[model samples]
Target: MNKFNGNKFKMDYSQFKTEVSKRRRSAATRELTKIAYSTPHSVISLAEGMPNEETFPFTEISIKLNDGSDFVLEGNELAAALQYIPSQGFPPLLQVIREFQRKAHAPPLWDSREVLIVAGGQDGLSKALEAIIGPGDPILVQNPVYPGVNVVITPHNAELIPIEQDDYGVIPICLRKRLQEREASSLKMPKIMYINATGANPTGTVMPLERRKQIYRIACEYNFLILDDDPYHFMYFTDEAPRSFLSLDTEGRVIRLDSFSKVLSSGLRIGVITAASPLVASIELHMQSSHLHAPTLSQVILYKLLKIWGYDKMMEHFRRIRSFYKERRDLIVKVAEEHLLGIAEFSVPSAGFFLWIKVPGIEDTWKMVMQRGVTHGILVAPGAAFMADTSKPCNAIRASFAKASYKEMNVAIERLALLIKDELAKNRSILNGNT
Candidate 1:
């Protein structure tokens, strides 16, 4: 009987190098990849990374030219589309992204090879961290950060020192204190500062220009890198636009992560890293080794879209996306007002997909979310899940207005209100008993 097929092959299985065990791999991702590769055709698969082909914009793509001509790509064109391309990105799309980034953010120290297309914003962020931060290096972060940041820093055994944030996001004083504290304790200074400045995760607080200026100054003063993880950069619904760290950067210290996920399509898994060319080179090696490049087919698709739509038209498209999400945000806010106004105080998010609600009485929203999900089928993300300290008790929860229908949001908030009121009343009863 083989080890694999009832009759064992004579080949030595132990000859494989130990390097295979040393590479960083996600357990869930590995499982999914395994299932994707080995599953029989009869079994339906939800394990693969690729988005449903049907959900893509078109069955076939036709690009109309400016001069009443048309450029078309679909069957035959797709073969070359998947061919090996530069690890940085598709050549034409790289140029387009560079130009688009310039017109939009306009970082001062741009150069050739400064912008590289990554698989997604998370890829850009994790790879950037993995590239720079060696073992035990310290990195600065704003508290209640996007969890993806942790995935990067933890693997390197890097210390994540969180600076507490106010409603304005990343209080300058707190950041200064954290930096000074490291010095006071004789600890190594943090080499990088990772921030999700716009439409921040779970909190949705957008950093204003003044705060951006202060943070940029601190970065220059402290001589550290700034990892600007801004997936929600274009998702703002405010009257005036929120300024990005990239636009404020002067000393070439900012590595800006820009994503096409929120506005365009998450399925594309395309994002750009804008920085000085030298830093770009450092990060490029990571991509060169793993995944090699972003999906070539994705690059080709986006490039054609950009070519057809051009920059101005694409800006219009983004405006329309903003308008759509703005409408959704208004609907969610209206529902929240009706159900949760006084019970749990919350700021109306000017941009982004989430409303971060603070319930005054409750110590933590994690149990409440679970109870509601079990009893009433309403789900929300507990704010503590976003905290730097998982054990910390936070009185907040995040609700997204991204995918839920208006009626669903209304009902969900109503159920959530009931849960909060019940929790508050229960706490009061227990307190009275103790007294």
Candidate 2:
């Protein structure tokens, strides 16, 4: 892709790549491996120093499913699983995910698009940030952003400008207004905008289709890429999912990170990045120097599981997982409303596992949640953890219902209500004393 530069044309999105990424080169042996794998069976004599599979002790790997069914990995499959594969991903697994993404996202530039398998969603997100953000670069992030993203951004010394969000997720007007204001300011314009699109972390608010379209339109106008970090895509409580930024990205300005963590086993550490070919290639080069590739064993297992389940069955499994979390969402909301009805306020989460609650009297949830709530034998994420500026106070708290039982949730909320009241009374007393 080329952009008009006055009279001449220059590389367009290539500007999004940082100096660090531009300097990164694929490992020599890893590059050879790609060629070796692609050549005809008769052409491979021996170039790279790959280990002999005969020395591997494992003969087979047998996995038992919850339904008493099982699958065995042996012979050639076991050998491939035991060895290091291409940085892009194991071919078979990559094909399956591409098919899934096509069906799921229907990215507009499918032919020019590429998918790279990553160790996890966080790994993909971190690498993507590293590939683009240079020192002192300006980056736009959703307010109360994911802490993992903050960890990545901090090391780069990137200036994070927060975009305000509401029940429908990021407010389009707020984003547009911020950009308009930024034009007159001395701050450098941002090249990337990070968003958690579906079932956003901490808040559990999903961006509506219209809002996603609006955001994408703004990205096009501003000439910035949208980093759609959608780990909770399958965990949505709605009957149908809103259109993704990728689906609406006609200009290939959306770089989406999809994860198997929420709907599948997080421990497996499997994620995928779908973007334009060059962007995916740059990230793949970074992978070559880091962890060679996502765990081959995990990829093989996931590949086998998906093959046995097929596309239709896999989707059925997703529906079942959604139903399970939906039930939990209902329980948590009911309990919270019953206990903290008037003392505090919260929007019932439309997706994800968290309930973002606001306690009007509490100036900062750090003390209430980290100190008091912990003492009460209740555990919840403090809202400060998600803020762009952690030094500042946050009025909200994040309570997750993913693991707690109905009784435990009830007890937690009940205890939380007491904590809120106690804090409120103490604040009132302090104000009265000052006066």
Candidate 3:
């Protein structure tokens, strides 16, 4: 006979077990929700990879009716706030996206490629990945890539092969070598190659036109599909913005993902996928299965705004946002030169929101900084989160100039410099057996 303890209450523990099991398969993006909710302080969050909301052009936005009159919603944009529409999204919105793509990319008969609206660039990417990638298929991604892409690829049981990249974006020579090796081994060839050609995430590098052409040539030779994720295409502050792979893609092998989030409001969560008709159809089916479609109201509102303002006005707005971020980038670069250039190395980005800093000999920069620097109210994204394998050694950290004000940016950069100096001293002392 065994005596039972009263502390062990009689309950159906199996039911709780079942619920937990169901959640184990949930998407990794859902984990961010928990982190966002739990934090109390206003996180000077450069980690989200989101654009500055303050940059959106609200002043130029005005609604007009067909009856030769001005129209206004008391709630501002009710059409964007509340509505259920098409799975493919509003036709007018798709038409506007097509026109923008045509002028921006200068593709041959760019209108031939169809546009499908999605929840966000990530959503569009996930759907396209689902439609094309099967379990165990190889997906070639640049090393130290975007975390959102990692989230999508992991759950699909896809093999993520890391392609080496530099200041000019993915090195085509390295890519060709890797592809050839994989083919020689008789292993499955990569089904797709996902690239962020313009102002890449984590690493603020833009692929030059020559490099883009080289990569396109490799894709054609290898017979692998190209997923051109170009959210920051219009964010280039430099005079020479690189041509996209989609423009060079004669075989219709490139699927371009564009987002309004970078240049507009991220809260709207609007993105579009432009590709060949068959590929677009497959992506739409996946969208139908997942979300049915992007919000109808948001699409319509954007369409109306574009119709009234035109492309030139939109480009002007983009230039303003670009100037604002370019100043921030310059400020950060100045700080790094004064405080961290010798101790750390970084590339001066021509566009986009991030500054990728490399601190050699420190494998876990996040733990070192958070355990010490977070006490000073500074935060940064660890290099490991961007890598495919977190356990592997890495010496980089990603900082942003998008969200924080100039004053805050100055303070944060100073604090980061101090943290790096302290860590470096500690490492030196250990090497000398002084600690």
User: Worst ten-residue run, lDDT, model 3?
Assistant: 1-10
lDDT of 1 by residue, 1-435 (tens): 101122122222122111222343334443344354345879886654555444445445665644475766765465446455656777778879989998888766455327889998888987877766767888888898888887767766778798888887889999998889889999988778889888888778888898899989998888887889888887887677888888887776778998888877799999899876656655665675688789988888889888888999888887888898889989888888889868988887867899989998899888888765558668888888888766789998989999998888888889889889988888899999953
Clash number for candidate 2: 0
Ranking by TM-score: 2, 1, 3
Cα error, residue 290 of model 3, in Å, equals 1.9
Indicate which candidate wins on TM-score: 2
User: Which digits, one per residue and each the tens of the lDDT, describe model 2 over residues 32-53?
Assistant: 8777767798895477888999
* Per-residue accuracy of model 3 over 1-435 as CA lDDT, tens digit each: 100111122222222111222232322332332244345767654443334434434423456644354544334354333433445666568778888888888775454467889988889888777677666778899887888887886776878889988887899999999988988999888868899988899888888898888888897787777899999998886687678888897777788999999887797789999876656755665554567668866686677667776899788878788888898899999987887867888999877899999997676787776577687668988888888776676788889999998888888988888888888888889999996
Best of the two (1, 3) by lDDT: 1
- The deviation in Å at residue 205 for candidate 3 is 0.9
What's the best-to-worst order under lDDT?
2, 1, 3
User: lDDT: which candidate is best?
Assistant: 2
Overlapping backbone residue pairs in candidate 1 total 5
RMSD of each: 11.9, 3.4, 15.2
TM per candidate comes to 0.82, 0.95, 0.81
lDDT of 1: 0.77
- Poorest 10 consecutive residues of model 2 by lDDT? 1-10
Worst 10 residues of 1 by lDDT: 1-10
